[model samples]
Target: MCGIGGIISFTTDLGERHRTADEFAAALHDRGPESGGRWLGRHALLVFTRLAVIDPVGGGQPMVGRSGAAGGGRPEPAVLAYTGEIFNFTDLRDELTRRGHRFDTASDTEVVLRAYEEWGPACAERLRGMFAFAVWDAAAEQLHLIRDRFGIYPLHYTLTDEGFAFASEPKALFRAGQAQPVVDRDGLRELLGYTPTPGRTVFRDVREVIPGEIVTFGRNGLVRRRYWDLPAREHTDGLSETIATVREIVQDSVRRQVVSDVPLGVMLSGGLDSGIVSALADREVGAAAGGDRLRTFSMEYVYNLANFRSDEMHASPDSPHVATMVEHLGADHSELLVTTDDLMDPAEQLAVVDGMDRPIVGLETHVAFRRLASRMQPTATVALCGDGADELFGGYIWFQDPWYVQAATFPWIGPFHGMEMHSGLVDRQLYQELDVPGYIDQRYQEALAETPLTGEETAEDRRMREITYLNLTRYLRTVLDRRDRMGQAGPLEGRVPFVDHVLVEYVYNVPWAMKNLDGREKGLLRAAMGDLLPDSIVRRGKSPFPTAQDPAYRQSLRSRLQTISEDKSSGVAELLDVKRVEAVLSAPSQGLGAGVNRLSIEAALQLHYWTTECGVEFKL
Candidate 1:
């Protein structure tokens, strides 16, 4: 795991290139703190920061490879600046060696470079891990950027007058002057609306390299080809057979991901998705002779344990379940209890906004993850997370609720909820111009049109398939991005085993009936791994990540929103509706958490800070 940035410009001066490269490296310093280097070509410059996970002594970048003299007219050279892990690099290296390729270092970086040489662009099909990489082929005078099948890792790039610049995060591009901190009307729609367009970012010109995609750029302009996508296939396996297949795929993914040189741990949320991962990891570690006990980490709000209340979103606090699992596995566990003050800290909130490079909702959760990553960094470099399972296996409550399921728009942003939370504080005229509702419906239809189907399913099955596709493609990307930014901010790599393409493809084809076997969310997963976990965990209802229920947290948001409303020169003041802001401030404390008012206040404050601190220019 590392941070990578590069520029492919034929017109920029050498001095300017050096300055940009330096800024890129500095911006990404936290992502790779161990070492850093730069590779300069006549028309390309690559900068890499190293985390040294696979082979501490030998693994480094940007790695360069040259073709053999035999059958090679003027030995071609290719340079690679890569991030994320290739869990199957050992197998690829063996195959490449059999094909007469030699290696100088025991690193996945070398295997990736050789794979590019041996298979060219087709090599992306063979890789089975989370990654985003850039390859500069001097011979072709082209740059190739590739992201993993599920986009567990992030890569952003922007087109420039001379050429283009790419990086693991958008701040690196902005710092290097490759892109500006600007948001247009459409970008605001994307932000204020809960729906996420696949390749679009909050920043104007910066865009993501969509998952399972390879983008190539050169003097002939740019070309994009999708190397993989969720396949539409008929389900032939019976219920029992499907369960076994899911177990096998998930276990193999966990086993492959646990092979890390640096210390590793699991993020145990005490929910079924994370519990299954922890159990499998424990079994894998115990199977190894003389292996130490597996390490697990979890977090909760400081006052949540005593004052927690049941709601539709959170069924129960995670502490008791976490204890049950830790005892069942006899694991070495660590838990952090975060205070309301910690969640409300101005400096901490600013750090998260800066780290994310956008005004993000759920400030508390992001802050909690950042704190958890910092706690784990001293002992582990890699942490397994259960992010994609909910999206893949239908674990969210909205998935099972009839109203949400039958809604015309994206289920998460059904007519009654979610969308209003983001737009409640914005100016009425501006909100009308943004037209978040229209944008949501438009994007929703676009996503539904892209939903793959076999055409032989019942009406219910077809609708379920569309819902699953929306969750995986749109909702899950936001979850994955949050994990990437927070974990990488701690310089920790968070791996999602459930997101393995083989597993996603297989389960995506499973009929909704089989997925909801017992009329429960994630019933398929529970059936597959239930025996491995305590019964309580297997039976626990679906609960989203815990949040602070303390009224003081809401009180803090009200105070901040009040201050912003009073200050006419505030960066986000013009964007907000003063009447709406005053309504929130003057509302009774007891009425704060009712509906989505609390969420709206949080969003407004985050936007204010992001605009002020990042110098974001609004083009509305």
Candidate 2:
């Protein structure tokens, strides 16, 4: 795992290339603190900071490699600035060796370089891991940017005066003066809309390399080609066969991902998804004698156990379920407790926003994960998470709710409509100008148009498929982005085995009935891995990542909002409706569980901090 950034200018000379690369590297220091390197060419400059996961000494970047076909009339060598692990590197390496490719290091980076040399951009199709990488093809004078199938690792790029620049995070581009931190009307709409627009970011002119895409920038400007996508296919396998295949693919993904040179562990959430991963990982690691016991980690609130409240989102505290799993697995486990004070700390809140590179409404979740990553960093350099399972297997409540499944908008947005009153607090005229509703409708239609279909499924099947696609392609991106930004900020590499494209592809075609076989969310997943987990965990309902339920947390938010409302010169003051803000601040405390109060307060506070701290220039 590492941080990669670079500039590619084909028409103009970059005199300050070294300085720009240095700034980019420095901005990404936390992501890769072990080592750093740069490769400069006439038209391209690549810089990378290393986390030293595999073959620490030898696996360095920007790694340069000569194309296997580099002779006669071929292009020059390709230089790769890459991040994320390639679970199938050893297998790909063996194939490459058989095809006469020589190896110099036991690193996936080299395998990726050689694979690109052999297969060109099509090599992205063969890779089966979470990654976002850049390959400056010296021969063709074209720069190729590729992200994994699920966008597990982030890569953002923007068109520059000279040519273009790309980085692991948008901050690097801003820090390098490649892109400005400006949010226009559309950007603000995106910020508040909660509907993800692929290839677009909250910063204008800055675009993300869409997941499962290869974007090439060269003499002709730029071209984007989808190297992989969820295919619409008919399922012919029986129930038992489907279950067996899922088990096999998931286990293989876990087995492959455990190939880490540094200390590794699982982010055991005591849910079906993470429990399955933890169990499978334990088996894989324990297979080798003298192998270190699998380490597990979970998060809890300081007073959650004593004052826990069941709401629509969470059924019970994770500690009890966590304890059950820990004892059942008999693995090394650690629980990190987060307090309302921690969630309300100005510095911690700002850090969460900074890590996300945007204003985050889920401040508690991000803060907890950020701290959890910090705690895990001391014992693990890499941790496997169960992120994509929900999207792939119909695990969220909206997936099972008919209201959401049949809704015209994104499924998750329906329930949140009543809960998300922050929009009402925005300046009325400014909110009208933003047209967040129209923007969301437009984005929803666009996503629906892109939904792949077989043209043979029943009406119900088609709707389910569309819902699944929206979850995977749109909603899941937010989840993965949070994991990547927070985990990498801790300098910990987070892997999601459930996101393996092979697994996602196969499970995506399964009918909705089978997916919700027992009329429960994630029923298919439960059937496949239930035996590995304690029966209680297997029977537990879907509980989203826990939030601070303490009433003090609500008081803290109200206090902060009051402070912001009184500060005349506050950056976000002009954007908010003061009367509305005061009303929210003065309203009786509803505790933090009410999505409306919590999310509204969080949005206002985050917007204030983001605008003030990040020096954001709003062009509305």
| TM-score for each candidate, following the candidate numbering | 0.97, 0.97
lDDT of 1 by residue, 1-620 (tens): 68999989767644346787899999998789899888987789899998888988888889888855421222668889998899999999999888888888998888998899888878999999999999998888899999998788889999987789999999999898888989999899999877668888988999999999999989888899999989999999999999999999999999998888889899999989999988888877742324798899999997899999998788899999999989988888999889999998898888888888886768899999989998997778889988899999999877899988998988876634653776778888998887888998899999999999999999999999999999999989879878888886567889999998899999999999999989999999999989998999999998988888998998898888888877777789888876677677775642344344666777888888888887888988
Q: After superposition, how far is residue 510 of candidate 1 from its true place, in Å?
A: 0.8
Q: Whole-model lDDT, candidate 2?
A: 0.86
Model 2 stretches with alpha carbons more than 4 Å out: 67-75, 287-290, 421-424, 589-596
Q: How many backbone clashes does candidate 1 have?
A: 0
Q: Give the TM-score of candidate 1.
A: 0.97
What's the CA RMSD of model 1 in angstroms?
1.8
Clashes of each: 0, 2
lDDT of 2 at 516: 90
The per-model lDDT (C-alpha) reads 0.86, 0.86
